[model samples]
Target: MRRPVESAQYTSGQYARFARDHGVRLSVGRKGQCWDNAVAESFFATIKTELLDRQSWPTKALAHKAIFEYVEGWYNTRRRHSSLGYLSPAAYEATQETATERAVA
Candidate 1:
Protein backbone atom coordinates (compact mmCIF):
# COMPACT_ATOMS: atom_id res chain seq x y z
CA MET A 1 0.00 0.00 0.00
CA ARG A 2 1.25 3.46 -0.87
CA ARG A 3 0.93 6.40 1.46
CA PRO A 4 -1.15 9.24 0.04
CA VAL A 5 1.79 11.62 0.33
CA GLU A 6 4.17 9.20 -1.41
CA SER A 7 1.64 8.50 -4.14
CA ALA A 8 1.04 12.22 -4.60
CA GLN A 9 4.74 12.96 -4.98
CA TYR A 10 5.37 10.27 -7.63
CA THR A 11 5.65 11.54 -11.20
CA SER A 12 3.50 9.93 -13.86
CA GLY A 13 6.45 8.22 -15.49
CA GLN A 14 7.71 6.93 -12.16
CA TYR A 15 4.30 5.66 -11.25
CA ALA A 16 3.74 4.05 -14.63
CA ARG A 17 7.13 2.41 -14.45
CA PHE A 18 6.42 1.11 -10.99
CA ALA A 19 3.10 -0.25 -12.16
CA ARG A 20 4.77 -1.93 -15.09
CA ASP A 21 7.39 -3.43 -12.84
CA HIS A 22 4.69 -4.82 -10.59
CA GLY A 23 2.60 -6.06 -13.54
CA VAL A 24 -0.23 -3.79 -12.48
CA ARG A 25 -1.59 -0.58 -13.93
CA LEU A 26 -1.86 2.66 -12.05
CA SER A 27 -4.53 5.12 -13.11
CA VAL A 28 -3.09 8.14 -11.44
CA GLY A 29 -5.19 11.26 -11.38
CA ARG A 30 -3.86 14.71 -12.16
CA LYS A 31 -1.73 16.29 -9.51
CA GLY A 32 -3.06 18.37 -6.58
CA GLN A 33 -6.39 16.59 -6.58
CA CYS A 34 -7.89 13.60 -4.79
CA TRP A 35 -11.37 13.55 -6.31
CA ASP A 36 -10.11 12.37 -9.67
CA ASN A 37 -10.18 8.75 -8.46
CA ALA A 38 -13.79 8.73 -7.36
CA VAL A 39 -14.79 5.81 -9.59
CA ALA A 40 -12.05 3.52 -8.28
CA GLU A 41 -12.74 4.61 -4.73
CA SER A 42 -16.39 3.84 -5.24
CA PHE A 43 -15.59 0.36 -6.53
CA PHE A 44 -13.39 -0.35 -3.52
CA ALA A 45 -16.13 0.90 -1.26
CA THR A 46 -18.60 -1.43 -2.90
CA ILE A 47 -16.22 -4.36 -2.60
CA LYS A 48 -15.74 -3.70 1.07
CA THR A 49 -19.42 -3.20 1.70
CA GLU A 50 -20.76 -6.16 -0.18
CA LEU A 51 -17.93 -8.63 0.37
CA LEU A 52 -15.45 -7.75 3.07
CA ASP A 53 -17.85 -6.18 5.52
CA ARG A 54 -20.20 -9.10 5.33
CA GLN A 55 -17.79 -11.81 6.42
CA SER A 56 -14.83 -12.63 8.57
CA TRP A 57 -12.21 -15.14 7.40
CA PRO A 58 -10.07 -17.09 9.81
CA THR A 59 -6.93 -16.81 7.73
CA LYS A 60 -5.26 -14.68 5.08
CA ALA A 61 -5.62 -17.45 2.50
CA LEU A 62 -9.31 -17.78 3.12
CA ALA A 63 -9.75 -14.02 2.90
CA HIS A 64 -7.83 -13.98 -0.35
CA LYS A 65 -9.98 -16.71 -1.86
CA ALA A 66 -13.16 -15.03 -0.70
CA ILE A 67 -12.15 -11.71 -2.18
CA PHE A 68 -11.16 -13.42 -5.42
CA GLU A 69 -14.55 -15.08 -5.66
CA TYR A 70 -16.31 -11.85 -4.88
CA VAL A 71 -14.45 -9.88 -7.50
CA GLU A 72 -14.20 -12.44 -10.29
CA GLY A 73 -17.21 -14.71 -9.90
CA TRP A 74 -19.81 -12.47 -8.30
CA TYR A 75 -19.03 -8.81 -8.92
CA ASN A 76 -17.72 -9.09 -12.47
CA THR A 77 -19.99 -11.86 -13.61
CA ARG A 78 -23.29 -11.38 -11.80
CA ARG A 79 -23.59 -8.05 -9.99
CA ARG A 80 -25.72 -5.41 -11.67
CA HIS A 81 -24.02 -2.10 -12.22
CA SER A 82 -26.09 1.04 -12.48
CA SER A 83 -23.43 2.67 -14.57
CA LEU A 84 -23.83 -0.12 -17.14
CA GLY A 85 -27.60 0.18 -17.30
CA TYR A 86 -27.96 -2.30 -14.44
CA LEU A 87 -26.17 -5.01 -16.36
CA SER A 88 -23.37 -7.11 -15.02
CA PRO A 89 -19.97 -6.46 -16.53
CA ALA A 90 -20.17 -9.76 -18.39
CA ALA A 91 -23.59 -8.83 -19.67
CA TYR A 92 -22.34 -5.44 -20.77
CA GLU A 93 -19.49 -7.09 -22.63
CA ALA A 94 -21.94 -9.41 -24.36
CA THR A 95 -24.03 -6.40 -25.41
CA GLN A 96 -20.96 -4.73 -26.81
CA GLU A 97 -20.24 -7.84 -28.85
CA THR A 98 -23.77 -7.89 -30.20
CA ALA A 99 -23.55 -4.23 -31.14
CA THR A 100 -20.27 -4.80 -32.94
CA GLU A 101 -21.72 -7.77 -34.82
CA ARG A 102 -24.78 -5.77 -35.85
CA ALA A 103 -22.60 -2.94 -37.07
CA VAL A 104 -20.52 -5.38 -39.11
CA ALA A 105 -23.60 -7.13 -40.55
Candidate 2:
Protein backbone atom coordinates (compact mmCIF):
# COMPACT_ATOMS: atom_id res chain seq x y z
CA MET A 1 0.00 0.00 0.00
CA ARG A 2 1.20 3.50 -0.85
CA ARG A 3 1.93 5.79 2.06
CA PRO A 4 -0.20 8.90 2.55
CA VAL A 5 1.53 12.22 1.94
CA GLU A 6 2.07 14.08 5.19
CA SER A 7 2.96 17.57 3.98
CA ALA A 8 0.84 19.83 1.77
CA GLN A 9 4.01 21.01 0.02
CA TYR A 10 4.49 17.52 -1.41
CA THR A 11 0.80 16.70 -1.83
CA SER A 12 -0.03 19.35 -4.44
CA GLY A 13 -0.90 18.10 -7.94
CA GLN A 14 1.94 20.09 -9.49
CA TYR A 15 4.54 18.56 -7.14
CA ALA A 16 3.16 15.06 -7.71
CA ARG A 17 3.35 15.53 -11.46
CA PHE A 18 6.91 16.88 -11.21
CA ALA A 19 8.02 14.00 -9.02
CA ARG A 20 6.50 11.45 -11.39
CA ASP A 21 8.19 13.04 -14.38
CA HIS A 22 11.59 13.09 -12.64
CA GLY A 23 11.23 9.58 -11.14
CA VAL A 24 11.72 11.07 -7.69
CA ARG A 25 10.20 10.28 -4.33
CA LEU A 26 8.78 13.15 -2.29
CA SER A 27 10.11 11.98 1.04
CA VAL A 28 10.40 13.96 4.25
CA GLY A 29 11.04 13.22 7.90
CA ARG A 30 8.17 12.75 10.34
CA LYS A 31 6.60 15.94 11.65
CA GLY A 32 8.32 17.55 14.66
CA GLN A 33 11.47 15.49 14.06
CA CYS A 34 14.20 18.15 14.25
CA TRP A 35 17.06 15.65 14.35
CA ASP A 36 16.29 14.47 10.82
CA ASN A 37 17.04 17.93 9.47
CA ALA A 38 19.83 18.90 11.88
CA VAL A 39 22.63 18.50 9.32
CA ALA A 40 20.91 20.77 6.82
CA GLU A 41 20.13 23.32 9.52
CA SER A 42 23.74 23.32 10.64
CA PHE A 43 24.97 23.82 7.09
CA PHE A 44 22.61 26.74 6.57
CA ALA A 45 23.64 28.27 9.87
CA THR A 46 27.31 28.02 8.83
CA ILE A 47 26.56 29.66 5.47
CA LYS A 48 24.61 32.44 7.18
CA THR A 49 27.34 33.09 9.70
CA GLU A 50 30.25 32.93 7.24
CA LEU A 51 28.82 34.44 4.05
CA LEU A 52 25.21 35.67 4.02
CA ASP A 53 25.54 37.72 7.19
CA ARG A 54 28.84 39.24 6.05
CA GLN A 55 27.84 40.75 2.74
CA SER A 56 25.09 42.64 0.98
CA TRP A 57 24.34 41.63 -2.60
CA PRO A 58 22.70 43.97 -5.08
CA THR A 59 21.37 41.17 -7.27
CA LYS A 60 20.03 37.64 -6.88
CA ALA A 61 22.40 36.38 -9.60
CA LEU A 62 25.40 37.77 -7.73
CA ALA A 63 24.24 36.16 -4.51
CA HIS A 64 23.81 32.83 -6.24
CA LYS A 65 27.27 33.03 -7.80
CA ALA A 66 28.82 34.02 -4.48
CA ILE A 67 27.19 31.10 -2.66
CA PHE A 68 28.27 28.66 -5.38
CA GLU A 69 31.86 29.93 -5.22
CA TYR A 70 31.91 29.85 -1.45
CA VAL A 71 30.77 26.23 -1.32
CA GLU A 72 32.89 24.96 -4.20
CA GLY A 73 36.05 27.00 -3.71
CA TRP A 74 36.38 27.13 0.05
CA TYR A 75 33.95 24.89 1.90
CA ASN A 76 34.37 21.76 -0.22
CA THR A 77 38.02 22.20 -1.10
CA ARG A 78 39.96 24.10 1.56
CA ARG A 79 37.93 24.29 4.77
CA ARG A 80 38.98 21.69 7.36
CA HIS A 81 36.28 19.51 8.86
CA SER A 82 36.83 18.22 12.38
CA SER A 83 34.52 15.31 11.64
CA LEU A 84 37.01 14.21 8.95
CA GLY A 85 40.01 14.45 11.30
CA TYR A 86 40.51 18.16 10.49
CA LEU A 87 41.02 17.50 6.78
CA SER A 88 39.16 19.34 4.04
CA PRO A 89 36.50 17.29 2.21
CA ALA A 90 38.66 17.01 -0.90
CA ALA A 91 41.64 15.86 1.15
CA TYR A 92 39.51 13.38 3.09
CA GLU A 93 38.10 11.94 -0.14
CA ALA A 94 41.62 11.63 -1.59
CA THR A 95 42.79 9.81 1.52
CA GLN A 96 39.83 7.44 1.32
CA GLU A 97 40.53 6.78 -2.35
CA THR A 98 44.16 5.97 -1.64
CA ALA A 99 43.17 3.56 1.12
CA THR A 100 40.66 1.84 -1.12
CA GLU A 101 43.25 1.39 -3.87
CA ARG A 102 45.78 0.01 -1.42
CA ALA A 103 43.25 -2.47 -0.06
CA VAL A 104 42.34 -3.61 -3.58
CA ALA A 105 45.98 -4.09 -4.61
Candidate 3:
Protein backbone atom coordinates (compact mmCIF):
# COMPACT_ATOMS: atom_id res chain seq x y z
CA MET A 1 0.00 0.00 0.00
CA ARG A 2 1.06 3.57 -0.66
CA ARG A 3 2.04 5.84 2.23
CA PRO A 4 -0.65 8.18 3.45
CA VAL A 5 -0.04 11.84 2.58
CA GLU A 6 -2.93 13.76 4.08
CA SER A 7 -2.09 15.80 7.16
CA ALA A 8 -3.85 16.50 10.50
CA GLN A 9 -6.49 13.97 9.63
CA TYR A 10 -3.93 11.30 10.42
CA THR A 11 -2.82 12.03 13.94
CA SER A 12 -0.19 10.05 15.80
CA GLY A 13 -2.86 7.93 17.43
CA GLN A 14 -4.48 7.22 14.06
CA TYR A 15 -1.12 6.50 12.46
CA ALA A 16 -0.23 4.09 15.24
CA ARG A 17 -3.45 2.23 14.78
CA PHE A 18 -3.04 2.22 11.01
CA ALA A 19 0.52 1.00 11.25
CA ARG A 20 -0.46 -1.77 13.65
CA ASP A 21 -3.31 -2.87 11.46
CA HIS A 22 -1.55 -2.68 8.09
CA GLY A 23 2.08 -3.24 9.09
CA VAL A 24 3.01 -0.20 7.05
CA ARG A 25 4.33 3.16 8.13
CA LEU A 26 2.24 6.27 7.56
CA SER A 27 3.98 9.48 6.46
CA VAL A 28 2.63 13.01 6.34
CA GLY A 29 3.94 16.19 4.79
CA ARG A 30 4.83 19.14 6.99
CA LYS A 31 1.91 21.34 7.98
CA GLY A 32 0.04 22.89 5.05
CA GLN A 33 2.68 22.01 2.45
CA CYS A 34 1.85 19.52 -0.33
CA TRP A 35 5.00 19.64 -2.43
CA ASP A 36 6.71 17.06 -0.27
CA ASN A 37 4.66 14.35 -1.94
CA ALA A 38 4.79 15.71 -5.46
CA VAL A 39 7.69 13.60 -6.64
CA ALA A 40 6.03 10.36 -5.58
CA GLU A 41 2.71 11.52 -6.98
CA SER A 42 4.34 12.29 -10.28
CA PHE A 43 6.03 8.91 -10.43
CA PHE A 44 2.83 7.03 -9.72
CA ALA A 45 1.07 9.10 -12.33
CA THR A 46 3.66 8.22 -14.92
CA ILE A 47 3.58 4.53 -14.13
CA LYS A 48 -0.18 4.47 -14.19
CA THR A 49 -0.30 6.20 -17.54
CA GLU A 50 2.46 4.24 -19.21
CA LEU A 51 2.15 0.83 -17.63
CA LEU A 52 -0.89 0.11 -15.47
CA ASP A 53 -3.48 1.72 -17.68
CA ARG A 54 -2.39 -0.26 -20.73
CA GLN A 55 -2.46 -3.76 -19.31
CA SER A 56 -4.40 -6.34 -17.37
CA TRP A 57 -2.95 -9.13 -15.22
CA PRO A 58 -4.56 -12.41 -14.35
CA THR A 59 -2.57 -12.69 -11.14
CA LYS A 60 -0.82 -10.54 -8.57
CA ALA A 61 2.54 -12.20 -9.26
CA LEU A 62 2.23 -11.40 -12.93
CA ALA A 63 1.33 -7.84 -12.17
CA HIS A 64 4.30 -7.51 -9.85
CA LYS A 65 6.66 -8.94 -12.45
CA ALA A 66 5.28 -6.64 -15.12
CA ILE A 67 5.75 -3.63 -12.87
CA PHE A 68 9.32 -4.71 -12.13
CA GLU A 69 10.08 -5.10 -15.79
CA TYR A 70 8.42 -1.82 -16.75
CA VAL A 71 10.41 0.10 -14.14
CA GLU A 72 13.80 -1.52 -14.65
CA GLY A 73 13.69 -2.39 -18.31
CA TRP A 74 11.78 0.45 -19.92
CA TYR A 75 11.45 3.38 -17.53
CA ASN A 76 14.99 3.34 -16.17
CA THR A 77 16.75 2.42 -19.37
CA ARG A 78 14.64 3.71 -22.21
CA ARG A 79 12.15 6.39 -21.19
CA ARG A 80 13.41 9.91 -21.59
CA HIS A 81 12.83 12.65 -19.03
CA SER A 82 12.59 16.28 -20.05
CA SER A 83 14.25 17.31 -16.79
CA LEU A 84 17.29 15.25 -17.75
CA GLY A 85 17.63 16.92 -21.13
CA TYR A 86 15.61 14.12 -22.72
CA LEU A 87 17.97 11.43 -21.46
CA SER A 88 16.79 8.22 -19.96
CA PRO A 89 17.52 7.93 -16.24
CA ALA A 90 20.12 5.22 -16.87
CA ALA A 91 21.78 7.38 -19.48
CA TYR A 92 21.81 10.36 -17.17
CA GLU A 93 23.32 8.27 -14.40
CA ALA A 94 25.96 6.90 -16.76
CA THR A 95 26.87 10.40 -17.91
CA GLN A 96 27.12 11.53 -14.31
CA GLU A 97 29.31 8.57 -13.50
CA THR A 98 31.57 9.34 -16.41
CA ALA A 99 31.90 12.96 -15.39
CA THR A 100 32.77 11.94 -11.86
CA GLU A 101 35.43 9.52 -13.10
CA ARG A 102 36.93 12.18 -15.37
CA ALA A 103 37.05 14.64 -12.49
CA VAL A 104 38.76 12.04 -10.30
CA ALA A 105 41.30 11.24 -13.00
Candidate 4:
Protein backbone atom coordinates (compact mmCIF):
# COMPACT_ATOMS: atom_id res chain seq x y z
CA MET A 1 0.00 0.00 0.00
CA ARG A 2 1.20 3.49 -0.79
CA ARG A 3 1.24 6.13 1.88
CA PRO A 4 -0.59 9.36 1.20
CA VAL A 5 1.06 12.69 1.97
CA GLU A 6 -0.33 16.19 2.32
CA SER A 7 -0.40 17.86 -1.07
CA ALA A 8 0.68 21.29 0.16
CA GLN A 9 3.19 22.01 2.89
CA TYR A 10 1.69 25.38 3.87
CA THR A 11 -1.90 25.99 4.88
CA SER A 12 -4.06 28.85 3.66
CA GLY A 13 -4.02 30.39 7.13
CA GLN A 14 -0.22 30.30 7.32
CA TYR A 15 0.18 31.62 3.79
CA ALA A 16 -2.29 34.44 4.39
CA ARG A 17 -0.47 35.46 7.59
CA PHE A 18 2.89 35.36 5.80
CA ALA A 19 1.64 37.49 2.94
CA ARG A 20 0.11 40.03 5.32
CA ASP A 21 3.33 40.32 7.33
CA HIS A 22 5.60 40.49 4.28
CA GLY A 23 3.46 42.94 2.27
CA VAL A 24 3.56 40.70 -0.76
CA ARG A 25 0.85 39.10 -2.85
CA LEU A 26 0.66 35.33 -2.79
CA SER A 27 -1.30 33.02 -5.03
CA VAL A 28 -1.53 29.27 -5.35
CA GLY A 29 -0.50 27.74 -8.62
CA ARG A 30 -3.38 26.56 -10.75
CA LYS A 31 -3.50 22.85 -11.58
CA GLY A 32 -1.06 21.82 -14.35
CA GLN A 33 0.89 25.09 -14.18
CA CYS A 34 4.31 23.46 -13.92
CA TRP A 35 6.04 26.43 -15.50
CA ASP A 36 5.16 28.56 -12.49
CA ASN A 37 7.62 26.49 -10.43
CA ALA A 38 10.27 25.93 -13.07
CA VAL A 39 12.82 28.45 -11.78
CA ALA A 40 12.74 27.05 -8.23
CA GLU A 41 13.05 23.51 -9.60
CA SER A 42 16.04 24.56 -11.68
CA PHE A 43 17.78 26.09 -8.66
CA PHE A 44 17.42 22.91 -6.62
CA ALA A 45 18.59 20.80 -9.53
CA THR A 46 21.74 22.92 -9.80
CA ILE A 47 22.34 22.67 -6.05
CA LYS A 48 21.99 18.90 -6.08
CA THR A 49 24.18 18.51 -9.14
CA GLU A 50 26.94 20.82 -7.92
CA LEU A 51 26.99 19.94 -4.21
CA LEU A 52 24.63 17.36 -2.74
CA ASP A 53 25.24 14.59 -5.30
CA ARG A 54 28.99 14.66 -4.64
CA GLN A 55 28.86 14.32 -0.83
CA SER A 56 28.24 11.27 1.34
CA TRP A 57 26.75 12.40 4.62
CA PRO A 58 26.91 10.21 7.69
CA THR A 59 24.67 12.41 9.85
CA LYS A 60 22.21 15.27 9.72
CA ALA A 61 24.80 17.66 11.17
CA LEU A 62 27.32 16.77 8.43
CA ALA A 63 24.73 17.21 5.71
CA HIS A 64 23.62 20.57 7.12
CA LYS A 65 27.21 21.81 7.31
CA ALA A 66 27.96 20.75 3.75
CA ILE A 67 24.80 22.41 2.46
CA PHE A 68 25.60 25.60 4.36
CA GLU A 69 29.13 25.76 2.94
CA TYR A 70 27.93 25.05 -0.58
CA VAL A 71 25.17 27.69 -0.40
CA GLU A 72 27.01 30.45 1.48
CA GLY A 73 30.67 29.94 0.65
CA TRP A 74 30.73 28.47 -2.83
CA TYR A 75 27.39 29.02 -4.54
CA ASN A 76 26.59 32.58 -3.37
CA THR A 77 30.09 34.03 -3.53
CA ARG A 78 32.05 32.00 -6.05
CA ARG A 79 29.86 30.14 -8.53
CA ARG A 80 29.06 31.97 -11.75
CA HIS A 81 25.38 31.77 -12.64
CA SER A 82 24.60 31.95 -16.31
CA SER A 83 21.19 33.40 -15.58
CA LEU A 84 22.95 36.33 -13.93
CA GLY A 85 25.12 36.94 -16.97
CA TYR A 86 27.85 34.52 -15.93
CA LEU A 87 28.51 36.34 -12.64
CA SER A 88 28.24 35.03 -9.10
CA PRO A 89 25.21 36.41 -7.19
CA ALA A 90 27.51 38.58 -5.11
CA ALA A 91 29.38 39.89 -8.15
CA TYR A 92 26.14 40.64 -9.96
CA GLU A 93 24.89 42.63 -6.97
CA ALA A 94 28.16 44.57 -6.92
CA THR A 95 27.84 45.34 -10.62
CA GLN A 96 24.31 46.57 -10.07
CA GLU A 97 25.56 48.95 -7.39
CA THR A 98 28.17 50.40 -9.75
CA ALA A 99 25.63 50.83 -12.49
CA THR A 100 23.24 52.56 -10.11
CA GLU A 101 25.99 54.94 -8.99
CA ARG A 102 26.90 55.72 -12.57
CA ALA A 103 23.28 56.42 -13.38
CA VAL A 104 23.02 58.83 -10.45
CA ALA A 105 26.21 60.68 -11.33
**TM-score: model 4 vs. ground truth:** 0.63
Q: Write candidate 4's Cα lDDT for 1-105 as tens digits.
A: 995543664435566688879997755575456776786787899989987899788899999998898889998899888779999999999999999999999
Candidates ranked, most accurate by TM-score first: 1, 2, 3, 4
Better of 1 and 2 by lDDT: 2
Clashing pairs in model 2? Answer: none
As a whole number from 0 to 100, the lDDT of residue 46 in candidate 1 is 97
Q: Give each prediction's root-mean-square deviation over alpha carbons.
A: 5.7, 3.9, 6.9, 6.5
How would you encode candidate 3's per-residue C-alpha lDDT over 47-92 as one tens digit per residue? 9998888978789999899999999999889999877889999999
Ranking by lDDT: 2, 3, 1, 4
Among these predictions, the greatest TM-score belongs to 1
Model 3 misplacement above 4 A: 1-6, 9-33
Over the stretch 1-103, how does candidate 1's per-residue lDDT look in tens digits?
Answer: 9655454445556777878999986666667677767757888999989888897878999999998988899999999988899999999999999999999
**Deviating ranges (above 4 Å) for candidate 1:** 1-7, 10-13, 16-26, 32-36
- My TM-score estimates for the predictions, one after another, are 0.67, 0.66, 0.65, 0.63
- The residue-by-residue lDDT of candidate 2 on 5-41, one tens digit each, is 6556745668778998999876655556567667578
Relative to the true structure, how large is the alpha-carbon lDDT of every model? 0.83, 0.84, 0.84, 0.81
**Candidate 4 minimal-lDDT segment of 10 residues:** 3-12
The deviation in Å at residue 9 for candidate 3 is 7.2
Scored against the true structure, residue 44 in model 2 reaches a CA lDDT of 92
Error of 1 at 51 (Å): 1.5
